[model samples]
Target: MSPHSSNDGGFAKAAGAPAPQTIVTDAEGLDAALVTLPGGAPAYVARPGEGDTYPIVLIAQEIFGLHEHIRDIARRFAKLGYLAIAPDYIIGYGDPRTAPDIDAIRAIVVRVPDAETMTIFDEALAFAATKGGDPSRAAVTGFCWGGRIAWLYAAHNPRLRACIPWYGRLDGARTKAQSRWPIDIATALKVPTLALYGGADPSIPLELVEAMRTRLKEAHAPAEFIVYDGAPHAFFADYRESYREEAAKDAWARALAFLRARGAG
Candidate 1:
């Protein structure tokens, strides 16, 4: 979805958000393209131009779905020598990329069941293995809408070496499609996770972040939560006004280190 699109009823882009600063990555050297997953879903795959095998990183997209920003994220991981695959996990709810507004995006999001998405991830990993991806050395990271799913995927997939979720929701009302939140899985998390949050994010309260932190500590889960003071939600989204260069750069460094430390690098 175009964050600058005015058709979103003012929900697509935050109010007073800085003028859109879309950053597009040139795919001049990387092997990047739109490929079909084993399950027939469309996905963006990016990797080094010449690699016998590379670590796998599955990128989860924002509520806007598989847009250019998300594709750029995959390319970023590819630059770090990863076989990054960003699948269109938001299937069956229509295309959020072209959705007229946030309400339309939200409607499709609420209907996406975790079970289906997890299964799609399973397929995506299998697809990766065919493209010189080492499944044993794999990680998962997501932004905004995908961020929350990253938490669940870390718990669901034991093979993942690391997980990093950026500004994902910690707690929320449960539904048939979404029966669990990050807080609900904190105590059971099995993979090393580095979670980044915006201290000023109005949608996600600091209290929930603290609660999740407490739960992880109590369970001795391998996870770290970092809050960037005064940073707004989606601070890593450079295309939007919420982007904070300092927080985003620091978080990116921490994410790469976390993944590499756990052998996903």
Candidate 2:
């Protein structure tokens, strides 16, 4: 409900991460709050003061869950005149921000079933509809762990106008829970997506990007993949050392254009 608290939850500052942004706590015009889903799931929401009804963009969080960086992303979308929501989709595994190490976070996160996560997204959309968010003008975009989910959600939600998946893994070993990788679902994507990726992300090899690119082309999916030279994973996260200002700025422009082109503007 209040501005994001980096100290309370979130990984310890990564080396060379920019100092966290200061919140103008008393500022008006934009309001951010928490909302509970039908089955008691929690989500962070931000909206502009001037809109009676606005385009909606759901921002899926990175592996860090609803950390300050993720909250800032939702706020960014809201300031752009959207009803932006970021659901802590990592429910039931305990707060990711509370995990002591990255491996610990992954151990719990990897156990979440895709079916449950997808259902939560549907619940999120229903929640958005109640808050002046127009379902017809809906868009979804996400980073890291969330970026991959954006791809899956695009396939699952026919109503989404656009999707942007930023730096999520393209191929991975399948488990019972995460049965479909991006490559497996490329042909099924239902809307336009501006796929932003880092050419140099070690965790996500360029081979996988190219593979996904080829699959999208073969399937004639309405999506475009653009890789930023020399950038690495989590490049849009200014609060991390991996942030690349040039790539991040360019991706932001493309994301706005992609969503606005479809209706999320």
Candidate 3:
């Protein structure tokens, strides 16, 4: 692992503990087991070992790829009576964990086709369905880069009950790998999506955020964006200096409520 510090130029793993609200599981009944997606893709599954079938929460990884953080998020969902799965969807492109820097990760990301990601997640959903997860009670939530995918997934899967996109860009320059940006699909959403964003995120201008809001409102789409004033991007990442404790707390509360209200908890 890269020796990271808060002042690093780009992505840095949390150096030590005291992670804002780290939850440790004894791996008791709440165990996270390795699983394979329909196509043999790698995934980590977490659920209450003693309970009945649970709602499914499909977790999309950060730009950093599926790491301990994403797995922990799955474990957290298990505690909430939901079976969560975090798949290493980017494996076909490249592993973000080995990138050494954010720019390198972006290089891999820029070349990853959205269609491929959509299909992988679809297979992942199929895998979750077999693990006793209720497909009708399914939801999706992702962070940063994955947040953008959350929006796309909401549009792709008509069965998603709810979705939350965290600080994902509302608009961006398109590439061959990425034919459409989130803004392009605002009017195409079939499910309710709650987008949580940071007001001061340098990468995402407020105007784009407003534009996305306006488009969604005009389309009468069931999507909403919550901008936390003064918070930077990736505020929910407790291990990073960009984390905003107050904003993260409020975001989680709102997400839990949205999930529960949609029968996805």
Candidate 4:
């Protein structure tokens, strides 16, 4: 086990949690599972059943943690011939999945240190190598809370080929655990990044998104931002009421194109 992993426990079912999406990707042609990594980190791993090797995609989960939506995303990546791994980095503090409300989930989220998260991702990469993943061909995509993480990870790990963050926060309070936001790291990004945002997201205003864009441009970072005019936060989360199919599909397609162009797909 890696020294960085936390073996607190697995995810707990949240009371009154919304039902999963009905259009989830299946494992018909994929090898997928909820497995324990070498460091004892829990993760949902998915890959093409017939492939000996594939590009790797490290998926970051929303505040809800490694729920059905995240797992489904992994399957979708696998179907596209990528080895997708979604590690449960927050299980140590407590299962955010079990939180009954947004505030309850935030309590668990703030405790997760950004430094520790980078290590967990490192472990995920190690595990991916053993599962026929091409370490040199790796990309990351995240949603909600994970979307913010995707931006940080891109800045932290230069080896990543690309990063795609779906409606991640651009600015926020600086806590010891989470000292930086997407906007703070814009100048430090080394990998090509594609950030998606909802124009109607009350949590992340347009001005902040533009501020991030300005920083990235000043730093000459290879980055792009796509804002859906009327989409709400979590537009890609089909299981949530905020899901916007048109925007989600468009974003997903653009993400794939960006990854491929950046040598990750």
The top-ranked prediction according to lDDT is 4
Q: For residues 1-265, write the lDDT of model 3, one tens digit per residue.
A: 1111121122233223346564344445574676678776787788877666889999988888777677767777887888888877787888787676777888888888898888888987888888788999999999988999989888999789999999987778888889888899998887988899999999998999999999999999998888999999989887666878899999999999999987788
Count clashes in each candidate, considering only residues at least 3 apart in sequence or on different chains: 0, 0, 0, 0
Q: After superposition, how far is residue 108 of candidate 1 from its true place, in Å?
A: 0.9
* Best of the two (1, 3) by TM-score: 1
Task: Assess each prediction's global lDDT (C-alpha) against the native.
Answer: 0.85, 0.82, 0.81, 0.85
Q: Let me know the TM-score candidate 2 reaches against the reference structure.
A: 0.92
Candidate 1: tens digits of C-alpha lDDT, residues 1-265: 1012111112233223334665666565688877777677888888888768999999988898887678878878888799999888895678787677788888889998999899888998899899899999999999998999999999999679999999998888899889999899988899999999999999988988899999999999999999999999999988787899899999999999888899999
- The 10-residue segment of model 1 with minimum total lDDT is 1-10
| Per-residue lDDT over 151-204 for candidate 4, one digit per residue giving the tens place of the 0 to 100 score | 998888999999999998888999999999888888888899999999999999
Model 1: residues >4 Å from true position, as ranges? 1-20
Q: Write the per-residue lDDT of candidate 2 for residues 1-265, one digit (tens) a residue.
A: 4543233333333222345543322215676777788877788888886768989998888887877677777777888889888887886776677667787778878998888888888898888888889999999998999999999888889789999999987888899999998789998877898999998999989888888989999999998999999999988878776778889999999999988888778
**Which wins on lDDT, candidate 1 or candidate 2?**
1
lDDT of 3: 0.81
Candidate 3 residues lying further than 4 Å off, grouped into runs, are 1-26
What TM-score does candidate 3 get on C-alpha atoms? 0.91
